[model samples]
Each structure stands twice: as structure tokens, then as C-alpha cells.
Target: MFRVVTPKNDQEFEKYFAFRWQYLRQPWNFPPGSEKDEYEQVAEHRMIVNSEGEVVACGRVHMNTAEEAQIRHIAVHSAYHRRGLGQMMLGALEAVARDQGAIRAVTNSREISIPFFSSCGFVIEREAPTELGLLKRQQMVKKLTDLSSLVLHPKWCTELQKTWSETIPITEHMGIKLHQYTGKTLETRASLNKNINVHGTMFAGSIFSLATLTGWGMIFLQLKEKQLEGDIVLGDGDIHYHKPITMRPRAKCNIESLSGKFSILESNKKCKITLQVNILDDDTPVAEFKGVYWILPGKEASDAKRT
Candidate 1:
């Protein structure tokens, strides 16, 4: 097994820089010290180490402004490709950025790595300057904030939990419960023991259900925060399972990923919104879910259809 860590002592720092140089600088024929920058003293660094104490991946993040952070020096050992260590390292760097009050993160990624960064919730904003006047790069950005236009209240979370238990009886049986809500982000979790499959991992169907409700809950809170009445339903959804979950399953939905118009609901018209939910195994993204939700006019309209 591999673990993510921060280099503290002199020996660990030596190994960390050497690993960064090997994958990031050496391949481009750059000198040894080219792997590091002046921000080393102010930036946050993370690396993944194998059981044998070898560093397989490393990255760094530094605040460029009070609300903006820049990620740099991302490198993963060739032998450790496709193991999700890159995402794990990015997660650690972003966490540090958030703690330091950064609301967004930016990175200059090579053309070959744009797709990998996109899968981690980054979008290309524009073309960045070439590296060493050779490799073309793209400027990518990702939001790190949980704040939205609507203010969140603790009582809203309580009401959402009650609605789930009373309306969807299956949520209780599946062990789904609201884990947290930070106004713009809603986090929920399900018990692995209750939803485990024959393969000894979280059932695919259970993961879908967990992610579905988490997205639904975010929309539900948004409407409640705006004091708008509506009947929300899952119009459609797609989930990509990157890895199995042997531990308890948790899903997080952010308002930053939300797009669409909710104003039409005030005119008694249906509206649609799309959002994403990330299923995590202790800060590592294990699955990604994008969902389209529809909000019908009001509770009366929903009740009329059933009648």
C-alpha cells in the first residue's frame, strides 16, 4: 500500500526533491536544481510514498493572491501511473490552498496532461506560455470555495434529512444520512456494511443511489434557501466509477459545479440545472457523478400529477 505525506526532515526533503527532479526536470534535459522554485519556502508540498519508502509522486501549491493559488511541479513516477496517486497528491495540495483562504486554483499543464487535469475538475481557461520555450501548455483553473449566492442555515439541513427519511423510505434502509452542509456544498454518506456487494466492495447501484441523493439534496437546499417552492426530481445522471470503495462511502456536491437558471421557478415554470458530485475515499476521488435535475413549478403541480 502507498501513503501520502509531507516531507519534514532533511533526509525526506532530499528524497522529495530528487524524485521531483527525476520525473519533471530530468526528462526535459533541465539541470538538477531546476525542479524547484523560489516559492519552496512559502508553498505547501505533498508526496506519495510506497511501502518500500520510495517517493512515487509529488506536487506543490502556493498562494499567488489572497484568493488565488498556483499549483506547480506535479510529477508522478512512470511506474505508478494509473493508480490515482496524482489525484491524491492534487487533493492534498488543494486542501492546503483552501485552508490558506484561497478560493480558486490555477495550473499551467502540458498539452499531453490536459485531459488528466480536466478529469480532476479543472477547465482550460486559455493557452499558457511555453515551458523552456519548447512544450506548449494550457492554463487551467478550478474553484475551491463552498460559498454560493444563497446563505445556508443549519436548520435547512435538519429539514432535508427529515424529508429524505419521510419521503424516501429507502434512504433510511440504505443507511444514507447527511454528513455536512456548508451552504454551497452538501456532503452525505452511506454505510459500506449495509451496501457492500458480493465482490466485497461498495455496490455500484448503491453508489449511484448515494450520489443521486446527494445531488438532489443540493438542489433541494438551494430552493429552500431562496424561499422558492418546487418539486425536484432527477431528470438524468451519469456516474463513472474510478475505483472500488471498501470503506464507508461519502459523496460531496458543490455549488461551484452547478450551472443553469433557477429564476424561472418564480414564474411557475419548470427549470433545469446540472451539477456534479464527487465520491471520495478519504480525500481521494473514487467516483464522479454528473446529474441533471428538474424543478417543477410547485408542490401543487407535483401533487396534481399524482392525483
Candidate 2:
């Protein structure tokens, strides 16, 4: 297995920079230190290492503004091509940008690498200056705060968002929106300004509500994907607040944290599933919510049962 990590010591950094220089600069006849820049001291750097401790990929990200980040020096060894090391390194770098409160990320991609960056949710915004005044590049941009590009079932996610806004008017007022649903994970976000308390942070009740809706949306998406129908309701729930969220609040629910089966709903009128949702401020989890959801037969299923 390949693990993504930061350079924690001199030896690890040596390997990381060497790999970056070898893959990104050596072929271009660039100087030995041309692989790095002035941002090295402030940027977040990540390297993908194989099980044997060999660095195979490396990348860096640095904040350009409070809401923008620049990604640089993305390089993966030729032997690691098609193995997803590049994507893994990019993801780690993006996470660092998000953790630093960046809402968007930009990268300069060589012509040959444009497709790879596009596949990872970046779009060409404009032409970028040639690298070392020789290699042509394109400027690509992606919204890190809005994960809609990662949605596997965009139609279902949109339907769920519409249903929430129309059925629960409060959600609209809370600025709740479904951000992403990748079949296995659901992410939802709420505006802090819309849900903030007098203490200048997100209200506890709003946090709980965000988590509840996130978990509910996960079950909704799962059932929809499986061609099942249900009336999802929160049966029980508890929240543990670890910190106050001063920024926008986001809730994430993963399938791995869910327990129970949806197939049971086909045989019986009801099924129960427990799931966990984490509320995050930036990249730090500020609160955790555990909820038990009861899925009862939907109108069509109930009509069939009655018949």
C-alpha cells in the first residue's frame, strides 16, 4: 500500500525533494535546486511513499490569499504512472489548502498534464506563463469548498437538495446545501452567518441539525441508488461538541460508519440504521453526531403492502 505523508525529518525531506527534482526537473535539464521555490518554508508538502519507504510522488500547496491556494511541483515517478499516486498526492495537497481556510485552488499544468488535472476536478481558466520560459502551461482552477464535481449521482443529489428546501423551509433559511454524494459518502454545508449564535460562533442546535441532515441525506442517496423507497426519520441522536465553529460548518457521513441494512426494508415495513456525522470547521472536526434512523415504507411501498 502507498501512504501519503509529510516530510517529518531531514532524511524524509531529502528523499521527497530528490524525487520531485528527478521527476519534475531532471528531464528538462533544469538545475539541481530548480525543483523548489521561495514558498517551500510556508507551503504544505506531501509525498507518496510505497510500503518499502520509497517516495514515488510529491506535491506542494501554499495559500495565495485567505480564500485561494496555489498548487505546485506535482510530480510522480514514471514507474508509478497509472497507479493513482498522483491523485493521492494532489488530494493531500488540497486537504492542506482546505485546512488553511482556502475555498479554491489553482495550478499551472503542462500541456500533457492538463487532462490529468481536469479529471481531478480542475478546469482550464487561462494560459499560464511558460515554465522556465520554455515549457508551455495552462492555468487550471477548482473550487475546494464546493464538492459538486465529485458527486456520483448529480441528479439524485439535486433532487434531494430541492426536496429539502421545499419540504423543510428552515433548511433554506439555515443556508443548508448538499455539497457532494459519492455513493459512499455525503457532505453538506451550512453558512455560519445564517446559523451563528450570539457568541459569534455556530449555534449548537444548527450544528446538530446540519449533522442530522447529512446523515439523512446519506441514507436517502443510498436508498435511491439501490432503487428502494423509504420515509427517513431520525429515531434517536446525540451530539458531542468539541469546539465552536466560527467559520462555515460542514458535515460528512461515510458508509463505513453506517450500521444496518437497507435490504431489510424490502421484506418489512421498517428498518433501522445508525450512522455518525462529523461537523467540521475547516479541516478540524469540531463536533460529532451519532444518529439512529428509521426508514419506513414510502407511499408506493405502503400502498403495495396494503394491497
Candidate 3:
């Protein structure tokens, strides 16, 4: 629900405190700087915005030592409290720590906040101090452990099984799961009649999503064969229709050219490739497609104990 943390530069520092009086020094009447400690300069501040572009929540973090990190000054606007904004903020901070080689992450929670952090996978070890006068805090921690095997990379057979398991509306939707890749070639027959015509042809939108997904299936096949671990997401695309299908439509794709479109990926973190699938009616070309799709990098881990 929130974007990545952006460290505030000269242009963005003034927006941190929203109703600092209500959240920080409201009840006990503590001094102004008690809530905001010395971490502002060195630590990273992440802000969350609602659709209206108002900053509703904010968090600050700093690397405490060589092997540990700490989170400080995590606050959400009163109207937005109890929404798990704090938990999400910590999760984002934890990811930053993990990527930076931290072995452990810690946070000191106010008395009312101990239960919240505990539910976010932290364990309290002892009581500590707080900015508000005469308040006892809880010492909480979340350990950083190896997460390599939590990902699952599926194969041809495994993918088909997954598709079946996740498919829906068994009575209305029909799928022919191919056993393996057959060189980007797919031939499916669809009933067509003159009554299906707007301009004496099949509806264009039906052919669009179908043929686009046909090329998508081809990439799915190649990824299955390569055993490369990643998720395929459609970043963007463009489609062009060439002719009309007045009769049955047979479809085929040339993945070699499509594969060449991805050659740029070897040096880049992401790639966008255009694919063409010719829709033919009994050997007569009815429509042609020029579709572009964005491919992002993704990896997921499976459950360790369950597997």
C-alpha cells in the first residue's frame, strides 16, 4: 500500500512533523525534542501518504552498530491509528536492513505499543526507558535469518498443476494445458459465424486479450524450461489489428524473434519486448499483433517447515 522509503534531502525535510503536539507531548507534556532524538540526520525517514497526498505516517531508522539496527520515532496520525501503519513501516525498515547485511533489528516500544510490535514478529526481552516521563518501555527484537530457500521455482508439469489448482469457474472456462512447449506454436479452434460480426468479423477485444496471452504463454513455457527463478509481470504493451476473422481462427507465434527482444536483459535489470501473433482463418491472415510487455525481476521462497 506504500512506496519505498525516500531519504529526505534539502527539498523535503520540512514535512516531518504533523500534529507533533498531539502524538508526542500531548498527555505528559514532555519537551518538544523528547520524541525526536539525535537520529534525524543519520537515520532514514520513510513517509506514507494517503491517496490525497497527505503524510499520514512516518518512521525513522538508523544502523545502531556493526551487526544491529534500531527504529525510532515511528508515529501515525491520530485519525489513522490502529491501521498497522507502524507494522508496515517496520517491515520496510527490516527489508532495508536485510539488504544491507544487518544481523538483527531492534525497536523500543511504548507501553501501549508492545503488543503491536510483538504481533509483527518481535519478542520482548525486558523493560526499558521512554521519552514520556516515568513510563516503562519494552525491549523488542526481530532476528534476521537466511531466507534463500523460501522460494519455489516451478517446471512444465508443476506449472500445469498449479494452473489447474488456481483456475476457477470450471464449468464456464475451458483450458487445454499443454504437456510442454511445442516451439511457440498454438492452434485452437473457436466457433465463428457471420452473426458474430460488427464489420463481418469476430469482436476485436476478444482477439486482443486472447492473442496477447498466447505470447504470454510462450514466455511462460520458456521460463519453465530454463528453470530460472522469477515472476512474469506485464509491465506495458501495444496491440495492432490487421485484418478481420470471418471464419475459424488459428494462432501461431514466433518466440525466437521474441527471445532476441530480451537480449537487452543481459545488461539491464528489466526488459520490455514486443511480440506478434498472427491470427489466421484457414491460412488467410485475418489480424496481426504488435504487443509490448514489461518483464520485472521477482523471486519468492516457500515455507521451510511445511515443505
Best by TM-score: 2
Pairs in clash, predicted candidate 2? none
Report lDDT (Cα) of residue 104, candidate 2: 93
Q: Is 1 or 3 the stronger prediction by lDDT?
A: 1
Scored against the true structure, residue 247 in model 1 reaches a CA lDDT of 77
Candidate 3 lDDT over residue span 240-285, tens digit each:
6677778655554544336334444444345666666656564455
TM-scores, all candidates, are 0.53, 0.62, 0.47
lDDT of 2 by residue, 111-205 (tens): 99999989888999999999888999999999986646446567888899999998878899999998655465577889999998889999899
Sort order, lDDT high to low: 2, 1, 3
- lDDT for residue 81 in candidate 2, whole number 0-100: 88
Q: Which stretches of candidate 3 lie over 4 Å from their true place?
A: 19-22, 146-307
Point out the higher-scoring one by TM-score: 1 or 2. 2
- On residues 177-286, what C-alpha lDDT tens digit does candidate 1 reach at each position? 88656554677889888998888998899999999999999999988877887888899999999999987588877666789889989888888999999897655569
lDDT of each candidate versus the true structure: 0.83, 0.83, 0.56
